[model samples]
Target: MGVLSFLRATYDLDTLDTRFTNTSSTPYKTVIEARGDAAASKERAAKWKSQGQPSRWNTPEFYLYYFVLLLVIPYMFWVAYDASRPTDPKYKLYERLLRPGWIPGRKIDASDSQYNTFRSNIPYMAALLVLHPLLRRLYNAVVYPVKATGQGSRPTPEEADQRLNQRATFDFGFALVYLVALHGISAFKILLILYTNYQVATALPRKYVPAASWVFNIGILFANELCRGYKFGEMAALIAGPTVQNSVLDSGSTLVSWGRWLDSYGGLMGRWEILFNITVLRLMSFNLDYYWSLDRRSYSPVEKQIDPAALSERDRVSIPAQAKDFSFRNYVAYAIYAPLYLTGPVITFNDFISQQRYKAASIEPARTLRYAARFALCLLAMEIILHYDYVQAISKARPEWGRYTAAQLSVLSFFNLHLIWLKLLLPWRLFRLWALADGVDPPENMVRCVSDNWSTLAFWRSWHRSFYRWSLRYIYVPLGGSSFRTPRDAARSILTYVLVFTFVALWHDIQLRLLVWGWLVVFFMLPEMAAGFLFPKAKWEGRPTAYRMLCCLGAVVNIFMMMVANLVGFAVGVDGLENIIAGIFRDFSGFCFIISASMALFVGVQVMFEIRESEARRGINLKC
Candidate 1:
């Protein structure tokens, strides 16, 4: 009776027994507290997003090589076309460009021999690349601003301070570092190709070439890894050194030295660590996988997680146990295989070794050609999209992002985040084509990311799926994934996914913003997972129009939120991000329009594509 009265009074519930006339409205204090909390939580969530990370990415102007990639496609096409033309005007354009020719009448003349040598010089190209983006940035800052809004207004001290990278000097410094590292990576790539072509030859005796390639690659990478260890010496000195002199030691050393080591270490490593750390990580994966394969043990279907009903021996990617024998050579060679090294469909050692001896029959000529054409188009799309307005928006300082309409900022946010499609798409396809020609079946990295129907979880999983496979095999299943029935089991599963996101974030760039991005990813994804658990597809999904429509709405909102969070998370620094967050909240109406319009376009296109795809499938089935 007491419980009924309390419930009725507190919640204003209509009960069958209307004995208790406790129909008093919510208390003034309670209503005020709730409203305060609702407002406070929004502010709290925004600031909490930046806690303990005084930094944003705070990284360099990397990806200068993306410019090289942009130029390479056109060059490759020219080369192909140039090779085909057997006529008198053969290679005229390249010849003119290579030679010193400018403005028709007053044409600059040069010795062809001297000009050719200087023109093809790697240093010259690297310098040009390093300068191009920097110049463009400077031009935006000084000579010409892209948007009228950016040019018209002068910012306050706070606004100026909010700009993430206002230092052209720092950009130049990092651009130099970027160019140097790029040169190393390019050298590594060239060496790898030369090494692979030599190693994969039929004439080269088994074990010799792989061993030589291993030694060759490992030796190169080990040198870089050794240089990375130089920091440990600095670390030791920082840890060992005392503060406040010998007089302080009489009373025991001051504890001011506590964070000195870390500060020193960080000051020393700053941002160059990205270049060094990546090489070390790739080497670790390669070395570890090769070490495991030394014994060549074979397991039964159950142990290998092979279902009896799933695939025949012919259908599955199976290798003979004998084939798995670890040659230190194969390990090193596969680890540093140029195409797979940098942008990977992050393949495993065992799979890589197996592919080394792939049967020619498995590679259908027609299929490879089709795949090439389709992927070529994808590459073109990637290049075309790089020229997008959103790309330019992020390029310049946006400390005053608030001045732009929230819709403009939202478009910037959405596409800036989504342009990763090109980064992954361009490289993965180019590498995959070469890998395919080598008889290696590279798994798809991205599958329908844009058209993934706005499911946050699906988009995350679909993007870089090969890496997801690696995570599953190495991280997820090992942690007892997908068996969450109890609270403890559920925590384990969620923690495993959190680690997966962390790994992905850290893998891309070792930054807290990325870790937060990962957190946001898993947070957004969890609701869908919980919903799937509670409501089975047959019972709750696709049964009625309204339920399905609700699902679609949920999907759109999730995707929009995902894009917003990602953009802010990936913004240059905390202040730039702060401006964006503040801007969105200041004009919530404009944000809503941005979210709705962006989603309507994204989801609407996806829906139409899916419908067309479904119809095509049906037609194919009918024909069959």
Candidate 2:
């Protein structure tokens, strides 16, 4: 069995035994009633901000990113090509490299037509720059009417057409320029993003232009806002609400169901899935933010776990929407904002729209330069890391796993989490920088160090925070959350995990792997849950040193268990996981003994650090 299975069977899990809240709590009922329509809170527009409009877009520093891009793209092609031809030492090694994935009709050598060349891919270099102006014009037009009608009125046909005139006049011209200048672009890789962007631009309503452009034109982007905001999973459940369990099903029906899931969920085309989901799934949040902005009843201070009694008369959530009309352009731009379209720090519609005015602000030139430098450094770091080809390096070495010692493999398993961190870290940094250039302060994703998370809970809270917030704010709070007036039941705690994790896993994809991974996380989180149940008001440090030491040891074993579980569910295959488990018990080698000790020592140190920090933060008055 895999490490996770072994742990699952062996670990002595403590059940959270507590009194159940048999009836609905007053707090829960209040949240339910207050959710229907927002009570009039102070306009969010008048709220304070610390970032304070960092810099404007028009400065020369804002254009520094173009130079950085020029440097990176060539390097990407070089790395991809070089990885394909590992042994060959020569530059322009396409003749040796067997690159089947890249586009054809490209030439590097006269000897064979198959040879890949950067020379052939220069048009893409041109296309990246060329597409920007077209995008800007189209986006500006969509947002123009939206800002003009601040009262939330629908745009008139004349208003739409007047804005669409820019597209009408220039859409054909831009397409022609693109076709001629960058005709050789392909369907895969980076081009796929460009292709999606092109499609979005083409899909923008162009009533006066060719009829094809307006055929499947978008209705108001906030169609969900106009209607009640429904999350994607909720919508899916409602749509598949008619599904009934049948005892008459056979194994073939199970396969059929899998295929159906693949079709309906993300498996149809994975890139399209990424494109569709990151843009659309958050529409519920987008719609809700819009709803909250318009209706006063939507803002419940208690919903955020804040005390309503502490709320001031001028209380608001940042700002209310001042524009009379819904800017489909603004909404779409924020949703699919290119850099963050795939990897996200998910800025809500309100936050994004609020920052646009700063994108137009006249700021100090020095600040603009500083922002550019910092962004360039961040991009440079990502590019440098990417060039290392860490994923491929691991994949290439996987076949020779037996050659490495069991302890080495376990160490690898542990650091696999770190590897995943580096992979995500760059893209998130890139997303933040990309948005920041436009004066939008997308919230910092990794506040705590990636590898230094004190506990499993702390790690997740910082990891993809926007998604976590959505789960907590939307799913957890409505389901009674931890705000129970009565003691929480073990069953309810488990149910909270079920809803939050299943939603997260299914949100990523409806695959078994993700489900397993999500459950693994739930298992890790159980310690925190159980602690809450067992110690309702007890303090940790206030106890005897012997007790605190015992707690520290438990924390060590807990983190190690989680590391193995994470590796089993995510990083390694079943065989690898099994090998690690077997090694832990069967391997009598000194290295195995050594690694076991180090892993324990490391976790102990981390736990101590956490306790120290907690004590420091509490100013010696409270015990952790």
Candidate 3:
């Protein structure tokens, strides 16, 4: 009777206030008083008021800066063309520049040279410039809508900030470092070419003419800087004044005087001069521009508030069902030819989130056969175009044919870049279906449950997708599911950085030195990682202009870095660090400034095109 009475007292039905009704009068009164006090205190809290609306980060000033950087492309083309011109005194410049370095008695005039280097490279450059925008547009049109529609609500500011920080830390710090290191090792083979070039140049019949010698010297310097450490500022300083001569001997009087003249300039102009004159600068500038245009939008509160478990039972399918929808035909059509597949058009949970809601159609034999035949043809054509023997034959027959003549080199570089896209698109689609079918019990919100940074950080995630998903599900989430506390988050950040980048670095080859380099640079995202924990409220709202600008800057910087690295890798192989460093120190010039300006412009134009295309496809006007 006593127990029943207590139970009856605790279970309130009549009173609207459950707390008071469920408890004894004395305790209930005390609880009510405490609650009242807390509510009153909250009411009295002060609120901050801002003077005005927040200003947009994307301004004309930013655009102007970007525009100037892209000019490097045209400038490099101009320089190369000029160098190959009959009136350019090419051999005289070489003779003047490298008087005592190697061969001491030969002089050649640029005007008399038979090499059509500039003309030959036009096709390659045109391909890049045209293909980049076309591909971007195709991706935006085909893929963006599929991903954007039916996305979950965005996240709150705090949640978004946390995710962004974590992503930046892991992707930038860990993945970039590891991948670059691995790439560096593979790139090291370029060094053999440099060494051979150096030997051949020295053994030439006469000492190289001043202009020719200077070009060779610059190439060597580029190789050195990339393989080893050469500060941009220092290189810029040396380039301003041409006196920063290399060891390649010149065969002309004017070469020595010209070198002396170049030694005199000491300001930004001099640096610009050096950066602009080098072929590597063009490549670097282009890369930086491309990077700048990448998407950097953060999730909105609605989008972030996802729970995978909340999905209805019917919506949940086995891994087999998931994989079933992804036929070989769709795989190649969607994955291979898709322009975004080339270099990632930002992928979000939104892109694949709808798959869970639909039933896949039964396999169609005719469709499968058609796709298979098309895929085979495409592969066969590409293989023929990229054949090593074909490339070697072309190079031997026409050494001065520029990129086309060096078809082997061109194809290899293209293959490397393209292969990344293939890996991302094909594997990602397959793995996503596999994960779903396997009944892995995805979180209530499949989109939110998966690591957001996985798509953004690593090129592989953006390109080779199977491994990307595995890393995210198995590695990222397990370490610290979305909302992590400080210390744990930091540990996860560092470890992820080390693991991903290290894997990428080691993937190409297992070299200790390459590993060391990968480790050293991979931690670049540590600052962003630390910031995530420290400033939980600092979230990035999707400001298209700002995002584009930053991506452009980052891309350009990355490309420049890669170009220098590529040069060094070409000259020194895996252990070319010493040689790369020595070459830069031995030959400094004033071409970097021009390169920087040109790169900025190129990136700006590309980004503008992308924004325009995106807006046009969406039937919306860009807000300038």
10 residues in a row with least lDDT, candidate 3: 444-453
The C-alpha lDDT values of all candidates are 0.47, 0.44, 0.33
User: Where does candidate 2 have its weakest 10-residue lDDT segment?
Assistant: 13-22
| lDDT, candidate 3, 1-624, per-residue tens | 475653443232211112112221122223334566866545423211122122322667646645554554444434433333335333232332211211233222211111122223335534543554354345435543233333446333334333323322222232223322323322222234323433433344333432344355445454544533233333443554556434222332454445444444333122222222222221221222122212213422235453332322222211111222223222222222221221222122221222223212111233223323333443344333222112212222222222221222322232333322222233232222222232111111111111111112332332233234434533455455343356776566677767765654443234565465456444434433343445443344456556545545554544434333332322223433333233333322213433544355345545444543433433322122
Write model 1 residue lDDT over 16-62, tens digit each, in one string: 10111111122222322355576776774555444322221222311
Clashes of 3: 106
**RMSD (Å) per prediction:** 27.1, 18.1, 27.0
C-alpha lDDT (0 to 100) for residue 158 of candidate 3: 39
Off by over 4 Å in 1: 1-324, 360-362, 388-390, 393-396, 451-453, 569-575, 588-595, 598-624
Scored by lDDT, model 2 comes in at 0.44
Number of backbone collisions per candidate, in order?
0, 17, 106
Sort order, lDDT high to low: 1, 2, 3
- Candidate 1 contains a number of clashing pairs equal to 0
| Per-model TM-score versus the true fold | 0.53, 0.52, 0.32
